[model samples]
Target: MSQNLGLRLCLVVLLCLSGCNAFNGGSTETASITPAGVPTDDPNATRGLAPGLTNHGVVDSIALGDAHEAVLSNTSFTIHGKTTVKYSNGTLRRQGERTARVVNPRDRRYINVSIYTQNKIRSDQKSTNNSFWSNGERVLVALSSSQTNSTTYQHFESRDPQYPILKYHPQKERYYTLFQAVDTKVINHTTNNGTTLYRLTSTEIADSAQLIEYSMNVKIAQNPRNLTFHAVIDSRGVVHEYRLAYTATLTETNPSTSVRVVSTTRYTKMGSTTVDRPSWYAKANNTTPEPPTTYS
Candidate 1:
């Protein structure tokens, strides 16, 4: 594979292993508040929350039926975010921004994603753009080449569910097992519309053993470091924002290299957004469809 492709693959793998998202631009009304029915001083208060808690009965008792369902049941939503990766010495390596739109009505699901990388900008006012579209089991992807000013399309039948979207559903056992809340706090947040939301903050960590159990391919020079996650869930059980960060040394090379990656995702205007079929779908053919590639 080419160097650029290799680097892209590595980044994709890293972001997948580290759960990512956090909303920005929300107003903060108060520094802290205590959640009802849960003791702030007790570290075990969040023992049965989805995405962390193992006790099913306790999860049902909470105001939020299922944290993931709020996201899954919505017919339309949009996620815009950026991820940055840095080397051991704090030098920038790779950075990219991604936007995804998901529309699910009845049993049919549609998703469109566009990713832009900072490294592939050309002087001719051209740039590399990779995009993906999926409708249920059918998938189409387009990769633009700066050198040729042409785009290549790959169509295929995807038996595996689309990622990041599929991964966002916290009801899945694998997804739930990836996080354990270490701290729970409440904060008063005011939205742009002046609506105040009682947000519960959960600080979570996933250790090396948990990562291995999840079958995440993470290479580390020494013991794997824990992945830190912070989420802000409103009183209504909606996860308005989430952020993930991790740093580790890779031992696969002769001399280990240290790497750090951080990503943030936000959800807004839920239940009102719309995602339509891509215009390029009409031009795609599946005669020699290639396997789908996952990018976070």
Candidate 2:
């Protein structure tokens, strides 16, 4: 009788473990658009922004409360854009374009992003067709299950850390914290195709300690140079474009060289984009799942 009871207990524990796996496992549903305007394949579809909401309304809501959290939680959209980074001498160092979908406005972890390089490459060589997605716990590459560091994931997930790829999703806390040591202002405004654009600018003087906190690879002298920012927002309160210009003295090598770097990004295709789940996700549902550490 004791042996039979022990067997029953083991079976019960196995059943509970199976249930937990089913709950935490990544989904494998086919991507489908519903009549209700929700994308069925999106894990966060049930938590998406209200249907037919306008950019203007989103902006007003953000301004009325916690700007970053409110905008991130209440806005959902698709955006595609290009980013160019140049050296102080105006030489282009890198340029790339990315397309992304945010099915759930409140949580950036539910986003899907695809990226490509602008420079032409040989067909035989693998092109930069990088893709990323988040499965609730953390971000993962579309075809792989390996975990990615937050900073690296944030780089491709949002592209520009200073100005997240989400048009209205500002990094308010980071901005405010940095601004305490800098000067910022609304430099100007312009109108185009019924949309008004406001330009905001900021400048900061920093030392090695401040630069280190930002995770920069290079070292700089005390009171190095200046770091400047310029962002343009549309009438509906969406960021149309942003640029960051930084100058500092390098401390990594001899002679302590001064360097300047500039990065610029532009956003487009805001409200009408959708991303399909990867094919592997569907396959995983029918078969035994590989360990989470597995990579494609």
Candidate 3:
């Protein structure tokens, strides 16, 4: 039970984009708009907002746990563009392309798009299995479960003779460790429907940074205390780029929670990046083909 609770907590934290702390400043003030005039990018645009907020180069700070209380320290990555990697042979590689589906609740219309990538290698090696949906169902499955050279690269790293990958026992549920306890902060800003969203600003505080467990099935760390998420969402609440961070402690049971999951969950992205409906969403489905359902 404790393990389950811890896992759930970690899942929630990992799903938090712009940090859970920055979701402060809330008012139940609801606004309505005609379906014909609703902005395609902003799902909540009618809540009294304009357009042109998501122009290029917007910066937002996010906070979690304490609702923007104190400033965080020792931030590591000054996230600029996508993380780049170069092979030993000098061949540069990057993550796959990004795409989005614009949801217009008022008009009952949606637009599916694949934001093209600049790198030929990156684009060529990208996964085309996209799954766009109106709700949680699989609207479009464009890519197959094919592995690439990069995928094989990580697999080789795990099993390499020099740095043998951690072993995992299926029946017993065991595996080797992949990461140590670490801490870092992420900063991003984007405009949606003409609203300037400020994340982890000066007022927000970084409560605590601790190590937790990681998972592959859920692609999230099992940190009940602190989990980090970075989401580049479209106007209609569709995520374009989603990044997560957390720590993994090396212990039998967390002294704080006394739960066990073999090895700790680290700060790494799990699961395959296919085009499917938003994985972390329920009601706000982006499934293709059928129109998405929502509570008006």
Candidate 4:
């Protein structure tokens, strides 16, 4: 297939994978485990013991370290990632960053915006409903903006979001997949608004190979060194916030490079969020889709 056509086809697949109104995103959000099966053994009761070693009933039931996508669709959320490479002498070699904010995900009318930059160069991205950036041009799919608004979705340009475990975890589009194949320990636990929250941590224990297979200059994803993952999740297995960072040394370059990757995600205003139409689409926009009062 030609390069242009290939790019277009890739876009189509990604659109479907991203939970388009027609596709229901990817895997339907699984129902949260009921209260009966939920363990009520509070970790806070055993305050004398060390934090991470104590197995809170809540953590085991939810398998906090697993790759489970919380049911937060149609909610307002922001995800960001930054990858930087520098020479051993501390000179910047390359850097890439990407960010996205979704107003009402999986709705017909929405404002989902994303920006990707590599070494200060930005890619051609636009904030329009039912459209895509196809090889530097905006191509609108027939997805109705008034009916089932499918927003243009783009992956991070700074890094491939790739890992060594492909077959075991194929859904790279979902940022949470980066946490797969690891173990987590409850470092802290608390309650707010009658919701139980647990703060967890992990370090360099992910099941990955010693070397990244097809890494760019900043080779860290597959085999992150000194990996630090901090997750704040609720009782129902919902992640409210997460931060992960790791460092690596790249010897492929002349001076030998140091690499660092930091990723952060936050979910807010779920189930009542409203997306403002992009100025470009606001004039043509006749209707805006409001998030459902409740989501799975």
TM-score for every candidate vs. truth? 0.59, 0.46, 0.23, 0.50
Model 4 lDDT on a 0 to 1 scale = 0.37
In model 3, the runs with Cα more than 4 Å from the true position are 1-98, 106-128, 133-140, 147-196, 201-243, 249-296
Q: 1-296, model 2: which lDDT tens digit per residue?
A: 35324323432322211110111012222112122222335565333132111221121323422333344345555443333333456654333344456656423432332222223244221123334444433333432111222221221222222212223233343333333333434444555665555555666543334432332332333343567765555444454454555665556437655555443434333444344555444433344322333223
Cα lDDT of model 1 by residue, 148-256, tens digit: 7787766667734233343333233433443331233443334434323444444333345554433234444334455555555543455555555656565664687
> Which runs in model 2 stand beyond 4 Å of their true positions?
1-65, 78-99, 105-130, 135-170, 190-196, 202-228, 234-240, 265-267, 278-296
Writing each residue's lDDT as its tens digit, candidate 4 over 1-296 gives 25334434433332222212111112323223232222337655443222122333222322432323335442454333333334446655443332233443332222222222223234222222232211111211222222224432332121111211101111223433334434566655666777666666677444443212212322323334677766666765665555555566666545655665444445445555544434444323333322222213
In model 4, state the lDDT of residue 84. 39
Model 3 weakest 10-residue run by lDDT? 163-172
Enumerate residue pairs that collide in model 2: 72-105, 73-106
How many Å off is the CA of 169 in candidate 1? 6.0
lDDT of 1: 0.48
Q: Largest lDDT belongs to which candidate? A: 1
lDDT of 3 at 201: 11
Q: Give lDDT: candidate 2, residue 199.
A: 55
For all candidates in order, the CA lDDT equals 0.48, 0.37, 0.23, 0.37
Query: Of the candidates numbered 1 and 3, which has the greater TM-score value?
Result: 1
For model 3, the local distance difference test gives 0.23
Ranking by TM-score: 1, 4, 2, 3
